[model samples]
Target: MRSTIVRIMRIAGLAAVVGAAVVAAQQAPPALVSEQELLDGLKADGSRWLTFGGDYANQRHSPLTSITPANVNRLVPQWTFQTGTLGNFETTPLLRDNVLYVTGPQNVAWAIDARTGRQIWRYRRELPPNLTACCGLVNRGFGVLGDKLFMTTLDAHLLALDMKTGAIAWDVTLEDYTRGYASTLAPLVVKGKVIVGVAGGEFGIRGFLDAYDAQTGKRAWRFHTIPGPGEPGHNTWSGDSWERGGAGLWVTGAYDPELNLLYYGTGNPGPDYHSDSREGDNLYSCSLVAIDADTGKIRWHYQFTPHDVHDWDATEVPVLADLAINGQPRKVVMFANRNGFYYTLDRTNGKLILAKPFVVTTWARQIDSDGRPHLEPNQMPDEKGEITCPDITGGTNFWPPTYDPSSHLFFVNAREVCAMFYAWKPEYKEGERFTGGAAQRVTGSNQKAIGALRAIDPVTGERRWQFEYLSPSTAGLLSTASGLIFSGDADGNLLALDSRSGTLLWRYQMGATMHGTSPITYMLDGRQHVLVPAGTTLTAWAIPAP
Candidate 1:
C-alpha cells in the first residue's frame, strides 16, 4: 500500500521531536541551590517572609529552626515597630501573607501587621528638600511583585505600591535627582523585571542598571556601568573616564533562573581619590557583572578593582552557591571583597575560581592566579600619602555575609582596620556638584583593634573559624540551621554566633549602632522568630520556649 503509508509519516515525525525535547529540558536554569538545599528550603515553611535577602541568594540565611543555641537565651522582645524617622536604621523587612513590608527615614513606607505590629499602611516619600545623604538616611529594603509593592526613592523615584491597597501603583524616575543620583539599594524583581540600581558612587554619578516594567512602569533595559563609544568596555576608559566612569550598580542582583543570568555587583571607580580622572581597566567597575536577564546582555565580567583607587565598592551581596570544588560540582559566586579579597566566581562563566587574602591585606600584594588584584605600587594614592591595610573599611567584610549549607561555613564580618591614603588634586567644577576625588588621613598609622567573627572556606579561601567583635563590625550577617550566627555590633550588641564553634552564643543590647541591615528568620504560628532591624526599631527576637 505505498510502503505502509510512508511508515505512518515517519512515525509522527518522531513523536514531535521527542515532545519538543521534553519541553526544553523542563525549562532549564534553576539549579544553583545547595547550601543544604538553602537551609532545607528555609526550614521548609517558615510561612511567608518574602523577598529582600531572604529568597534571593543574598543569604541572610533564615530556615527558622525555631530559635536554637540551647533556647537562644530565651530571646524576648516580641514586637517594637518605631520608625519615627532617624538616620541609620537600615531596614530589611518583607514578610508576605501576614503583611509587614518596611523602609524608613525619608523614603518612608510601612504596611505592618506581621502578627499585630499594627500600622496597616503608610507610604510617605515627599523627600528632596536638599537630599544629598552620602551615608545615612538608609532604605535597603522593599520589592514584592504580584500585587505590586516595589520601592526605591531617596529622590530617584521608582515607586509601585498597592500590595492590597497601599495605593500609588506606578512612579518611575530612576535618576537625576538633581544629578547626584539616589536609590539606596533594594529593588530586585527579575523575571517580571523591576530590577533597579544606582547609588552615587560617592557622587560622581554615571553608573547604571535599570530594568523596570513589572507591568509597565516602562524602562525595560539599560545596563551601562560606564562605557560609551562602540561600547564593549569602550577600551576600558581613559580620558573622560567614559564620562565620570563610576560603575555603581549599587547592590541587589543574584538571579540565575537556570542561567538567565543577572548576577550584578559593581561600584568604585569614581573620583574616590582620583584614579587620575578615570584611567584604564575600568570595565564594569569593581566588577562581577553577568547580566542578560532577558537581554541586558553582558553575560560575563569579573573586574574586582581594576584601576580602582580604593573606595572599595564592589558593594557586596553576591552569594549564589553549590560548592564541592576539586571533587567536581562547582557553580560558585561567593564574595567578601570590599577590596580586601576573598572571592570565588565561575558562577557559570565569570571564571576566577578562587582568590584569598581574607583581610589585613596591604592593598593587594597578591590575589593573582586569575583572581587578579596584584596592585601595590604603594597601593596607589600618590601625591605623598599611602598607608592602606584594610583601611577604607575592609578586611572584615561589609554589608553582610552568610552561607551555611549545613556548616560549609562562610559567616563573615572581619574588619581589622588600616588606612591613611592621600590622593588629592581634583577640585573640578563644570556645573557644580563634583566629588570625584579627595583623600587624607595618614598620621601615626596602624591604629589596630582587628574585630573578628571569621569562619570562611567558601571552597578554600580558608580561615575556618574566629569570633571577636566588640567594636569594628559595621553590621549585617545572619545564619541559622538553628545553630545560629546573626551579627551586629559597633557596640550595640545583638550577637549570637556559635555556628559550629566561633562561640559567643547570646547578647542583645541594641541601644543603637547596628549599621548595615541583616538579620531575619521566620515561622510565625508554629513559633520561631529573630527579626533585628535596629536604630528606628523593628526588633522581634523570640524563643521563650517558642
Candidate 2:
C-alpha cells in the first residue's frame, strides 16, 4: 500500500510540470528578424537571406561550400512549387527560418514552407484596370524587418505584409501611377529605413529615390534625380524640360554601412532619341548618384553618357568592392552599363578609374580624362535611320550579375548584335509611350544574335574568359565560395559552371528562361539547396540525402 501511494504522487507532480511548460511556450513572442541579422547577410550557418543582393555590397556570392563542383552533378530536384500565374518571374525570393517569401507578377505573394515546397498563405491585390507599369507586370522581391515583409506593387504602392499571415500591415502610395510613375525594383532596407525608387523613364516621368520608416509607413526623405529650380544641375536641362526629364531608377543599388551612403544608377532622359528639346548634358540622367542614407543628400555623381541620345539608360546595377589598384588598396564600384561600356569607378568620390567597351559599340571610341565619352560622329538616330552596334538593349539590361571575390571576376551575359535606329518627334501624353525612337534588328549575311557569359577582371577592366551561349541569355547569376556559378540560358538550361575556368559542370532544363531572375542557395535539412524561380515554377534542388 505504501509503494502504490508514492507512485501516484510522483505521476501527479510530473503532469503539473508538463502543463506549465506548455503554457510558457504559448505565451512566448514570435521570433523577430533582428537588425543584426540583416547586416550579417548570408551567414555561414546558412540560416537566412535577409536582403536582395544576399548582402549590402550586392556581391551575390554565397559562402556555403556544402555543395561544390564535385557533387554539383548529383543535384536532383527535391520539389517544385508552381506560381500558377501567367507572367514570368523577375523577383528574388527571400528566405528566413525555413520559410520562403516570394513576390510574383501582378502584386501576388506567398509564404511557403521551405521543407515541403508548400504554401502557407497567399496574398493578392486588386489593381486598377489601367496600370502604367512601363516595363512589365512584375515585382523584383520583398524587404523584411521585424515581423513585416515589404513589397512594391504594380500600381506604385509599397506594402508591409505580415510575414506569418500574408496580411497587410500598412500600405503607402509611392507615386501616381496614372501619371506615368511605377516601381519594380526590390526595396533595400538599411539602418531603420526602407529605400526604393520610381520606374517609368520612357513615359516622361521624373524619377526619384525615397526612404520610409520600417515601423510606420511614413516616408523619411526623397531625393529627386532631376534637380529642382535653384539646385546646381537645374541648368543642365533646356527650359521646362526638367519636369519630365526621365532619369528613373529601375534597378537596385549597393549600400556602404561604413560610409552611410547609398549608390544607385539612374535612367535615360525623355524623348529618348531626339535631343533637340532636352540639351546640354541633361544633368543627373544617365549617371550614378551617391546619396547620404539619412538625409538624402547627393554626395557625388558620375555621368556615363552626357546628353545621351542612343537610349542607353545607364540603369545597370552598381556593385561595391574593395580592390587593389596600382599598388594601393582602394574602394571601387564596378558597372557594366547599357551603353556597351564596362567601368570601374572610385566608389568614394565617383571618379572613373577605367572604362572600356565590352561589345561592338560604335557610338563612342573611348572615355576621356574628365570621364566623358569621346563621341563618334554620325551615331545619333534620325528619321532616316542610323546603324549602331549593341542595338537598343545596349549590352545587358536589368539582369543581376555576380562578383566572386575569391576569383576576382565580374560575370555578365552580353549580347553581340546591332540594329538600325529610327527617330521622330514624339507627341507627349500623360502615362503614354514617350520614347521618340525605335530599334530594328539588323539581320544580314554577316549579322548574328549571339550571347556569351563573359568574365571580366575588375582591376584591369579586361576580359579574362567567356562561355558562349547559343542565344542571348537574360538569366542572372549566383556564385558560391566553392567555385561554382549558377545561371540559366535563353534555351531554359539551368547550368552550373566552374567559377575559375567557366567550364560547364552541370545542366538541367527548367522549361523556362530565368529571365531577370537569379537563384539563391540555403541550407535545409543539413544540405544546401539551390532555389530557382523560372516562369511559373519555383524548383528546389539539392544533392540526394545520404
lDDT of 1 by residue, 320-434 (tens): 8888889999878888887778888878888888888877787776777766777766777766767777777566433768888887778778787777777765654432345
Name model 2 segments beyond 4 Å from true.
Answer: 1-30
Residue 408 error, candidate 1, Å: 22
Give every collision pair in model 2: none
For model 1, where is the 10-residue window of minimal lDDT? 1-10
User: What TM-score does prediction 1 earn?
Assistant: 0.33
Estimate every model's Cα lDDT from 0 to 1. Answer: 0.72, 0.86
- Deviation in Å, model 2, residue 92 alpha carbon: 0.5
